[model samples]
Target: MPRRHRLTPEKHLKHAPWRFTATDKAVLTRLAQYRYLKSLTLQKLTGRPIATVNYSLRKLFDRRLIDKPHRQVEGFNHLNAPDIYEINARGRRWLTEEVPEVTTLSRTHTEGPPKHFAHSVAICDALAEIELEVATAGNAFIPAATILAKATVPNPLKMPCTIEHTFPNGKHERLETFIIPDGVYGVRYPDGRSELVFLEVERCNPRNPQTLFRASLLRKTLSYRALREAETARCLGKKSFGVRFIGLSDR
Candidate 1:
């Protein structure tokens, strides 16, 4: 398969309202059957170039009518290639209610019946922009962190570090990697600087209320001692990071 493009962060606009076309619905239905199909394969099925396939998928994804499958495959360059397209319960219901012609196959239903599937789709669109932004930033590629800290003083880790937050729940969600937004200026320690000097400017606005709330609860519920102990045992897993919240009034 040809190299598929990675999405950037500017595209994660979940709070926005959008509409999907009939073509978007068709592409999604095809993807729902395969759970993951390459743009080339989609072209063969739809009789178009890989570009059209991606465009349709992007629209469907932006609309939240389909999701990328959670599985990975070996790529041409030995990287983890994405394959399959699985429609979640939300997508199924949307198809049934909004576009009922293709409900032949029964679909499973989840608790939050995705009344805002269209909204989630908008978020996915924003995430594509975010992914593209990160891919191009080239701000000192740092090794994936095993733990989070303010900053590493004395350069103990001896590895390059990046300052950014992360969102882990994309269509093909990856591991605990930071989702560094574009326009976030990063400063690095010179060869002789004592402290690890750095600066950052927030860019992407995170609008997912549930994830933000859950992360906050987790931080408070897990005490310092308990968190440390769990880290020592390698039992506590890292959740995705989000935009840092400064003081703001709920009005």
Candidate 2:
């Protein structure tokens, strides 16, 4: 068997222009939505075979439309971890120019992967799974961008409000907090009914004491309770909405 020569970005630039396919555009769109995604996640989101996803990713990388940071290799277990990719400036421009329907593009990660890369990856995994399940159930999963398009309030996702609590000490306490969800989406059923949902990804760290975790979660719960009481969704142009929490383990 003959060995295949791996082409670098420079070599690809010198070669003849490569045309875009449906799969290629789909991959780019996903990148634009998530900002950072693993190769396997792209496969799941696109519902394509591993070979097809890898080929598309390779071609995109070679053309400098996407970036696979070396920092990913340093952070994860290299033996089995999939490559992480992000859309570069060129890719963003390509999508804006070539795909007119793609109006929303995630902000570029100028500082590289976030401080909590695992948490981000877990969020993407959960989203991919939920999206697939929604499709299987014959429903449409509308992403945050779509939901925000019709929003009346500015920056509704990061909501800020005040909460008042009556403590056991017979005293009234007021706390001001922000309700920032990891993601917001909507599920539309066949009966012309739609439900809005806020997604929060929680990770359990073995190093942190359980008591602290519980306290943190309690605060979040209170914040969400306040949000519901205030009918934040209605303010955001929705009748009602639900909050979903996805728990992840450090292991």
Candidate 3:
């Protein structure tokens, strides 16, 4: 009797159930990472043609794989506005099975008004653009897909430092808690160097500049400095990470 040879997955590809194309899965993984995207944004992320992106999105929607989040902005035309979408429950489950590398994202919920929903998606879209820039520039980029949701600064053993805020009248109070940052990812330069970026995208549009000063940018900076200080003290000759900030204007 002749010995039997093992069959390969490609050899059995014709008999297998339909699966998303590599592009589709890549786009889905990004959707899973970002939690929301519009068709235009999806095209940007996937580097696919606009028509292809739109058609694939429609197919995903038809299959109940993604959800369209509604916005409450007045005079907001859904057609004109970028439609917000996320992997629905079914989509999540499918991705977990197909792409085990992705740790499932927590279902994004909205406690704010629908307008805030629009802002959230806009912020994500902006970050996606930065990632596109890095990729197009021939640098290595790591999307949030592989990044954990929360990261502790100065490691688990050390406590984050806080500064005191002194008022003009001489009343001084300790600054409030530090933030964990919006996201962190690695970027490798073509020169073979890489750094983990502390990512923050300001989605808030101030009706005035006062709103900007009111936010915690200064305090956030100081907090990060403290983390760097802690690292310096804790380790020797280690390079430090930097913050990359991006802000969008209402106009």
Maximum-TM-score candidate:
2
Residue 218 accuracy (lDDT) in model 1: 24
What is candidate 3's CA lDDT for residue 213? Answer: 28
**C-alpha-based local distance difference test score of model 3:** 0.60
Compare candidates 1 and 3 on lDDT and give the better one. Answer: 3
Taking all chains together, each candidate's TM-score versus the true structure is 0.33, 0.81, 0.70
lDDT of 1 at 116: 37
**Residue-by-residue lDDT tens digits, candidate 1, 3-71:** 434331124544466666666666666544333355545555555666767776766565556665322
lDDT of 2 by residue, 1-251 (tens): 65433323545362558888888998999888777788888898888899999999888887888887665665686557787887888898888887877634222245355776777766766776777789899999887677887878877677876766565566665677787777777899999999998887887633222332233555567778887878877756786788888884443
Cα deviation of 136, candidate 2, in Å: 1.3
True-vs-predicted CA distance for residue 160, candidate 2, Å: 2.0
**Top candidate, metric lDDT:** 2
Per-residue lDDT of model 3, residues 109-200, tens digit only: 34333445655665567667778888888998765433333333324222256655555566655654545556556678988887666666
Q: Ten consecutive residues with minimal summed lDDT in candidate 2?
A: 205-214
CA deviation > 4 Å runs, candidate 1: 1-11, 73-83, 103-251
Error of 3 at 216 (Å): 2.6
- For model 1 the local lDDT of residue 50 reads 69
lDDT of each: 0.37, 0.73, 0.60
